[model samples]
Each structure stands twice: as C-alpha cells, then as structure tokens.
Target: MGIISEFKEFAVKGNVVDLAVGVIIGGAFGTIVKSLVSDIIMPPIGYLAGGIDFSDLFYDPTGGDYASLDAAREAGAPAIAYGLFINNLISFLIVAWAVFLLVKGMNSLTKKAESEAPADAPVEPPKEILLLEEIRDVLKAKA
Candidate 1:
C-alpha cells in the first residue's frame, strides 16, 4: 500500500483519534490551570505574604542596580526567577491533584458499572448426559 493510504489508516484508528482528542483537551486544561494558578490562587497567597509579587521574585547574580525583573532583563543581566518557578510548581501540584481526583472518581464509577451489569447465562449439559439421566431414573423406578 501507498504511504498516504497507510497514514490515512493509522490516523483513522480509534486509539489515534482518542489520543488526538486527549492532547487537545489536555492543552486546554493546562491553559485553565495556568490561569487558575496565576490569577485566582496566587493573588490571595501573595496578599497574605505582604503584597509580594510572585512573578517579580528574582535574583540578580551580577548585583545590577536594576529596579525590577524587567529592568534587569532589559539591561541584559543574568537573573534567576525563583518566584515564577514557585508559581509553576504550585500549578503542577494543583493539576496533579485535580487529575488524581478525576481518576479516582472514574475508577469508582467503572467499578459500580461493572457490579451492576447482568451476569452471563449458565451453560446447559450435553444431550448424552440428559439421555443417560432419563435412563437412570427409569431403571430406579422399576427397581
């Protein structure tokens, strides 16, 4: 078969389609998690930490006289943005927690569904067995 046909077959598969959908949803979820961490969650924490701006938390190794992180970057000074790393770490933890909860719920639902499903029918004995049983019953009656 041609490469194009092979590619088409692979792309049309259920697993590949499911994976593509999952990737798209995961990207969207990541964006939501980023926004949740930066906008909703960090503001309160920063406020409690005496109005500190987590995004601007950085260290200038060169000891430049820059006022802020932007100024340091503009002045071409090397800096480590530890606050941003903290924000990202918090976001990762939140996402992981949300995924764990979701998986746990899904597992419970799957188990419930499996438990509720009807069982298979029992198998019957073969014709020879049935015939032998009938003959045995008749002989016992005569005795």
Candidate 2:
C-alpha cells in the first residue's frame, strides 16, 4: 500500500527483470549490427561507388570546399549526409529482418509445442464421480 512496498513489488516482478535483460541484449545486438554494416557491407558498396566513404559522403551548403563530411561538420557547414543515411537505412533493414526471423522461429516453436501436446487429455471431469462409479460397479458385482 505504501510507496516503498509498491516499489518493492515492481522490482521483484519477473517481467521487469526480463525487460532489463532484453534491453541489455538489444544494446549489444545493435553494436554488432552497426559493425557488420559499417565494416563489412558498406566498404564494398563504397568501393563500387568510386571509393566513396559513406561517412564522408556529404555536400557543403555554405559554398565552401570541404574535403570530407567530418571537415564540413567541423567548419560548421550544413550538409546532407545521404551516405550515412544509406548506411543507417541498411542497418535498420537488417535489424528488422533479424527480428522478423527470430519472431517467426519462436512462433513456429510455440506451435510445434502446442501441437505435440496430447489432444485427448482430460479437460472437464472432476475425478470424484469416476471414483464413485467404480465403487458402485464393484458393489453391484458383489451383489
């Protein structure tokens, strides 16, 4: 009823702990996805695009000649960083795809588990009636 008790109840709940774990794993997964995009995938694409560095892909709006995106940013110039955008778009797609596959696999697993359970298992009988019926049949046979 008190604030401390409510806080204790919330902290002890399994859902909150599971959520914390998920957040930690998601952060780690994000780092791996970022590395996979920037290190492995983008380099070859940049090479095909005439050795363009995706991070350095930008244009200065101030009409000043800047060597790279970093330089333009350092010079306080406004620029459209389309290359970084592309990289981020790809990362988003990859992460989405990964999550989709994970969810699909989990769904399939759950369905499999459900299907494997016995369909004929007792759903209703209270058990006392069955025992009483057996006792009645035994007494009738004795008579």
Best by TM-score: 2
lDDT of each: 0.92, 0.90
Shift of residue 124 alpha carbon in model 2, Å: 2.9
State TM-scores per candidate: 0.78, 0.83
Q: Which 10 consecutive positions of candidate 2 have the poorest summed lDDT?
A: 55-64
Q: Count steric clashes of candidate 1.
A: 0
Q: Candidate 2 clash total?
A: 0
Candidate 1 lDDT tens digits, 21-136: 98999889999999999999999999999999898899998887777889889988898889899999998998899899999999999999998887686778999999999999
lDDT: which candidate is best? 1
Overall local distance difference test of candidate 2: 0.90
Predicted structure 1, TM vs. truth: 0.78
Clashing pairs in 1: none
**Model 2 — TM-score against the truth?**
0.83
